[model samples]
Target: MNTVATPSEVTKGKHQIDLIDGSFTASEAQDLVVPMLTKKINFHQIKRMSLFEKNHKDTCAPDRDRILELEEAKATVEDIFLQAKIEGKKVKMHSTIHITLED
Candidate 1:
């Protein structure tokens, strides 16, 4: 796990955090990313359910949209892993999380 960060480049009340950046084997990439995506999907699903239960009129549109987006990302990752396996090559992955104050 390699992390790259530049404190000087960050603005006040905002931060960019490097989560994962490295080359990994096919199985390793799957193990790292698939579960994360699944967890995100599950998180949105639960949030949607909670909102719906709290108010029957609530559509949970944002949560539904996010779940779809995450599912597509997971599928793309799976395809990349499959292709890497066929080619017998390692996969390069990079991810970052950004945080900022609302007000």
Candidate 2:
């Protein structure tokens, strides 16, 4: 599952987004858009490891971490577009995802 930030104003099981026309591929998002956003936001740097020392417990940690972030962002974008298309709402760039629990 993907994750995105939830706005304080929005209650549970609600979402908000701005809608716009056009679509792009995950590669485009990962390479062009995500880099820009991460740079702008100043994401944390991956720690360096020495040759003798074992770095991450997971061998694919670096790639896995980055891919996860990209996937989540992609999911958010897909969700926003899907909502706009289905609901005919004018949302773009940003949106919320809500989760519900059944009793």
Candidate 3:
């Protein structure tokens, strides 16, 4: 008794059949609670955040105040990114920029 599950069943918190002999079997199905972790993240924009934090912590050897400052900076950057997203603008990070004024 091989059965195939529909996308709706898989997505809508419905019980799914187990695979038997590479085919899903309804008779072998059991009511199961799927473990899922949902997080609000856009990896495309903030993929390097982990590395940034890791390197900063490791290299900077931050004291408590410095750590707090780092955390605040991270929050500020996130807020800027969110605001820019809402305003339909792109944000680019640059390591260094030189500006000069000619009078």
Global lDDT of model 1: 0.93
Best by lDDT: 1
The predictions' CA RMSDs to the true structure, in order, are 4.0, 11.6, 22.3
Q: What lDDT does each candidate get?
A: 0.93, 0.48, 0.39
Residue 80 lDDT, candidate 3, scale 0-100: 63
User: What is the Å distance of residue 70 in model 3 from its true position?
Assistant: 0.3
Model 1: pairs clashing at backbone N, Cα or C within 3 Å: none
Clash count for each candidate, listed in order shown: 0, 4, 0
Clashing pairs in 3: none
TM-score of each: 0.83, 0.32, 0.33
Q: Candidate 3's residue-wise lDDT over 1-103, tens digit each?
A: 7667576654554243332223212221111101110111223124345555767554332243444555565566556656765676645432332333334
Tell me the tens digit of each residue's lDDT in model 2 across 1-103.
5467556433455454433234544443334444554553333233223311454454555644665676677567666556656665644233243455334
Where does model 2 exceed 4 Å of error?
1-58, 94-103
TM-score top scorer: 1
> What's the distance in Å from true for residue 14, model 3?
62
Model 3 is weakest, by summed lDDT over 10 consecutive residues, at 30-39
lDDT string for model 1 (40-97, tens) is: 9999999999999999999999999999999999999999999999999999989999
